[model samples]
Target chain A: MKTTQHKIPTARPSGQRPSGAVVKPVGARPVIGGASSDRVIEFRGVTKLYDGGDIGLDHATFGVEQGEFVFLVGHTGSGKSTIMRLLIKEVQASSGVVNVAGHDLAEIKRKKVPYYRRNIGVVWQDFKLLPNRTVYNNVAYALLVTGHSRKQIREKVPDILRLTGLSTKLHNYPDQLSGGEQQRVSIARAFVNHPPLLLCDEPTGNLDPETSIGIMQLLYRINKTGTTVVVATHDHAMVDKMRRRVIELSAGRIIRDEAAGLYSRDESTREFAVRMRGARLGQPEDS
Target chain B: MRFTFFFREALRSLKRNAMPSFAAMVTVLVTILVLGVFIPIVQATTGAADEIRGKLLIDVYLRTDAKPADVARVRTLLADKTPNVKSVQFVSKEAAYAREKARFPDQYELLGKTNPLPDTFRVTPINPDKISEIRNSLLPVAGGGTVAVDPAIEEVKNRRDQTAKILEATNFIKITMALLASLLALASVLLIANTIRLSLFARRREIEVMKLVGATDSFIRWPFIIEAIIVGGLGALMAISLLAVGKVAILDPFAETFALIAAPETLNFGLLIAILLAAAIGVSAAGSTLSLRRFLRV
Candidate 1:
């Protein structure tokens, strides 16, 4: 799916906190990543310990440069979600530094968290669309929140919906749409603002093989537009087929990171796994 | 954020979470209904009390053999010189006898036409609060003082103890009612807060999605606030409707039952509705704001 380009809202100046944020004088401290426009996300030895003595993440260190489509692959309880949470600043790092879009998240005031989140888009495994809102409203919600003009919302929403292959289902509620279509709505909502970064936590986790591939293709196309897309999923087959930059997590720690990574050594085994999954999805084995 | 968008979202959420919205509305209805009815009843009771107090008067009876000139002078003195006296009316012995006869016809018949009633002046006080002071000023000086004693005046009956007791009772009622109304208002605020908290709890996921979508805390909160206000407003409307119905069906029909007391018109329907609506919206907004503060941290 393709559509005419639309304007994305520009990011706020780094280190300039929004109202209600703990106000610090501008340039109170040197900007964290001065002169580094290409690096979008940087984490240096970030550690996160939950309230009950459980380690959510342990001294994780990584950087995702601009316009890169990276996959974070891990098993359940491997801290994949924690990384996403940290990137979105849902939880703060217990120790060390975490920076997104050149603003140090630790330094970002609590009130400014929403402003920080607007710079990126996020998707979830559950396809968190408002049950009552139509596909159109769901997509427009992204623009509506960032306080876009009604004219901008009217113009931007349809283009993004078309891009996500949901233009035909504009008036359809989430329940009326198929799982794949609902996920498309989620994608449309996530990318409606054309955010600099897109974070998907198991975007295809709830989908069947054919539908999952369609979603991946859509995400791949979105990534081609120079928007950095980071997807955290355990879908080995899709990861293998894509052969993209993959960061692997094990027990709250990154174990393996590759420029172009596969989940396992054997591509045929992954293909068989995908076929079995398709079979369970009621797709013919041959397909 | 667009106002229309917030309004739409609030409406959608209210529909989506029908049970909580209904519960909140019901809470508002009960709370506002209590305040609405309680206020007017208090006003009506105070009016009735004041009417009863207004009728209280002091009677100065003359001696049986008193000269007419002395009676006339005393009446003039009460009317013109008494500090808090509102008005004075002289009732001759014949008029007094006629009034007594009208009041107790059988007793007058047993008296065999003898006019035993005394001539008196009824003194009405301008300020009920200064009744004691007026009574003290009117008492005849008995010994060793230059204060002139009108010997022809037999008794000064001001009903001081009775008036004090009545005023005390009315004040007690007023204070008790005010205290009760304040307690109910406090309870209403707490109930509203609890209901809004529950509604917000059910919509916590929606709030999470909103936050993820880059909504500022205010953007995420405004819909819930507006929804709460609407629920409160509906509750107020319902309460006002109920009050209007009650006024027509209960209060107006029974007006004769309270004919002895002046009707207090303080609870005008239009003014009461305006006040109730403002209170409903204000309280709901306050409750929602308090509850949303904890949840909108995302």
Candidate 2:
């Protein structure tokens, strides 16, 4: 396995972290539990069948503990995107319960969906950056809609940008940045409010392999700050290399769930060997 | 969000999408300007019709050879307390001749010597529709019908055709103005709505992004609302100012052409301006809000 890089891009010159900064000791967040608590995400027999008789998710059941990083691996149309939408309450489950950040999604009022979404950050494969706004304003937009004061926005935007290694490109528009840089800007915007749960749907889907590693490392450092992270991707090489908690799906069903699991049943070691050989010989890689 | 933020954003978008915004504003301006000019014209026409209707009256003439007592009885009958009679004015033969000379001096001079006009009573009715009733009561009855003239009465000239013409003209004016008012109102509403829909449709992507970033419906709605209001309000102000200029430059100078009605100064411009501004703001806001409903569902 390739050695994982644990580097934070740069440290602050002042040596004192800002309030609500994610540089605190690990496990500082308490793992609360009982018959009903400590689960950041819970889906019990959740079935989502869209109109026209297509099944989005078929009786999927899983739970993520606080601060856990879970990899959701599947091919295209494997219900990965549906899970992200369901988590954000963008699509309602056809049956069973979906709970996110201690709120039952089924009971959430339509009027309250915006407020509910503020507690959870979401990143998409396309980056979803506003082309009209600069990198700073794109991050500031998250706070702008939530009624944060200008003073608060001014104080928070720069810190988040610096944290996301985007301080130099603050005034640059989305089109002016690289694909990976645009993804980083979206991440900055997502994490600006310090949402406790961050959900990413194929964050590195459009980036090169080298840039993809950088993004994965960034997500890893964020997860270390006690923010629960769930990433849905089809990148088997990255999955096999990282070997984190994996949840595999096929045909809208959860086929396997394991701590430190690979991307698939038996293709882990062979996929890793092929990818490492391709990287060493500077050959074109395939997923 | 801060009010300044919303206001700034609105101004920014208005500037950014200058073409569509200008189109919307111009549409609003034309609508309000048309309304501002015509509404008063309609009101003035209705008022003039009312004035003309009030002046309609019937004239009752008496025979020159009628007895003094008969004349006195006819006068008493004409002046009887009736629900429809508003007032009675008596005119002697000499007075009637003088009125004739005044009205047609050339015709009177050709007649040159003997006074041929008869004494007359001009009767005004409370309701113009009751003119026939007054005429029937004043005319003398024949053996079989009331067509034969009484010895005391020379003629009962009600001028029914002239009254009918006036009434017909007034009704025609009313119907024409009402149709014109409704057509103009509908045109203005449609123009404003179409312009607003285009402006909002051009920026649908921005709204989708806002919604995805967790903006409540109000936050998503307010900037566009403010933008629409600015467009509407600016349009109304421009229209009113243009109308005022037009009145001063054109309508006031050609006052004789519209002599049947009150002057332009008496048109209650302040009220028209207030109403125009309200409508501009109202219709544009409603248009934008309704147009945005489908897009905000993202």
lDDT of 1 by residue, B166-223 (tens): 8888778778877887888788888888888888888788778888777888888788
Off by over 4 Å in 2: A1-35, A261-287, B37-162, B257-266
Model 2 C-alpha lDDT versus the unseen true structure: 0.79
After superposition on all CA atoms, what RMSD does each candidate show versus the true structure?
A: 9.5, 10.0
Least well predicted 10-residue stretch by lDDT in candidate 1 chain A: A3-12
* Candidate 1 structure quality by residue, lDDT tens digits, A54-93: 8887766666778777889989988899999999988888
Model 1 stretches with alpha carbons more than 4 Å out: A1-35, A261-287, B11-27, B50-160, B260-262
- When summed lDDT is taken over every stretch of 10 residues in candidate 2 chain B, the lowest stretch is B258-267
Clashes of each: 0, 0
Q: All candidates' lDDT scores?
A: 0.78, 0.79
Please report, as a residue range, the 10-residue window in candidate 1 chain B with the lowest summed lDDT.
B259-268
Q: DockQ numbers for every candidate?
A: 0.53, 0.44
Candidate 2 lDDT score at position A226 = 83
